[model samples]
Target: MSTHLNDGSLTPLYQQLMEEIKVGILNNEYVPGEKILSEMELSELYHVSRITVRRAIEELCTEGYLVKQQGKGTFVNPRKMSRKIEQIGDVMGFSEACRACGMVPGAKVLTVQRCPVRADEKRFFSLDSEENVLYLQRVRTADGEPIMIENSFFPYNAFKSLNPNELNDASLFKYLKNTFGRTPTSTSQTTLEIVRASTELATYLDIITGDPLFYMNAYFLDQNKEPLLIGRQYIVGSRFVFNF
Candidate 1:
């Protein structure tokens, strides 16, 4: 539905206006923790009385969809995760990192399964071209808020014997060691970048497209110093900070 308020509808003008603003919130036209247009601005745009706009916004605030910060205007209530700035050297799973920062960590798996290894994946794992790998893509959260998006590839054989339930709500590295007897001896390689979020990324991180993100790429190494898994992550820009 369009964001414009409909005056001809039987619904009260304030209710109609509320739906439009709510749609903007749901559509990321108003990002979490970002201020919405002032009452005057909204009233002018919707061609509604200022009293109608004010009542609609107040209802939104009472419904917990928005917050009014003193002197700062109304903001879409933030549901966010913030990882501290001291985690880069640990090279740990996000679950572990979140714990270290005193936040509850969770994962929402987008995809998880075994597949034929891509050429680059084979090179990373030093596998023959015929080998296959296990792939996992998840949105990581801290305290119920999306923190980062991760895509990882691991040698399928290393995980074939384990049940998915064993890893679902736990740290992947910890689960690998405890359930499958495989543990990375170290992590190698480091490449970091800041990139503009794409539409897909914006959906995952609950941010607007074109927002900046933090990117990191690394490889988990086996005891023999061979790559065990390849990990690439896009972290929400304002939600995470890493030590240099």
Candidate 2:
């Protein structure tokens, strides 16, 4: 069946269309791997031009709401993983969490460096402008499968001198607790929508351009309630499932 668009509201036709489609996905009215109506079908039903329908569908696909296969119709995402905010404390480590679920935990440490903090980084990590940050970039794997690509920042003053090997062998949170006697007492996170994987990310995570990627921004607090770290994780849709 074709989705509908109203002409009475002040909302732009495209936006109205997008919102309706988003609601359908969230409400489980349109399920994953299900094909959405074709542009011609939608145009005919909405009494709008095929271009209008095409634009709406294209935008949706770019925003990760839908996917299109050449010569095939657009379909909903086939793999959507649940990201539990409440489980941050118990299983903050991606590898560990995946392993607990019977998936192998694997990671590739892409970059590890101690760099001067950016203005935003300073604020996020609760550091002074002069303080540096230990930046760690890694792509985590589950059962030999790529799942998440992460770029995390830690206050250099807090961790003293963090070694590259430490992050590679064990969870960063575990290292902080065991080596420094400080653990994450709590965490705050935000998620944003982003599309188009970078070439580097695409190669590492094994996804193509225009593929869906979730941008997860997180802040971890220490036992003393001080901000311990700030990070961004780019998770592949296939490896993640977010459930409310």
Enumerate residue pairs that collide in model 1. none
lDDT for residue 73 in candidate 2, whole number 0-100: 88
Per-residue error at 175 for model 1, in Å?
Answer: 0.5
lDDT of 2 at 40: 80
Global Cα lDDT for candidate 2: 0.74
- List ranges where model 1 is wrong by over 4 Å: 1-89
Once fitted onto the true fold, the runs of candidate 2 whose alpha carbons sit more than 4 angstroms away are 1-81, 86-91
Per-prediction TM-score to the true structure, in the order listed: 0.63, 0.63
- lDDT for every model? 0.78, 0.74
lDDT of 2 at 156: 83
Predicted structure with the largest TM-score when compared to the true one: 2
Top candidate by lDDT? 1
Tens-digit per-residue lDDT, 11-71, candidate 1? 9999998988877776667878888889898888888999999999999988767999999
- Give model 1's clash tally: 0
Please give, for residues 1-244, the per-residue lDDT of candidate 2 as tens digits.
3556777878778777777787788677897899988888777777777877888888988878799999988998753444444245443566556655556677678888889989878777777887899888988877677888888888887765776677664576677778888877667665566666788788889888667787777777776767878768888865586553
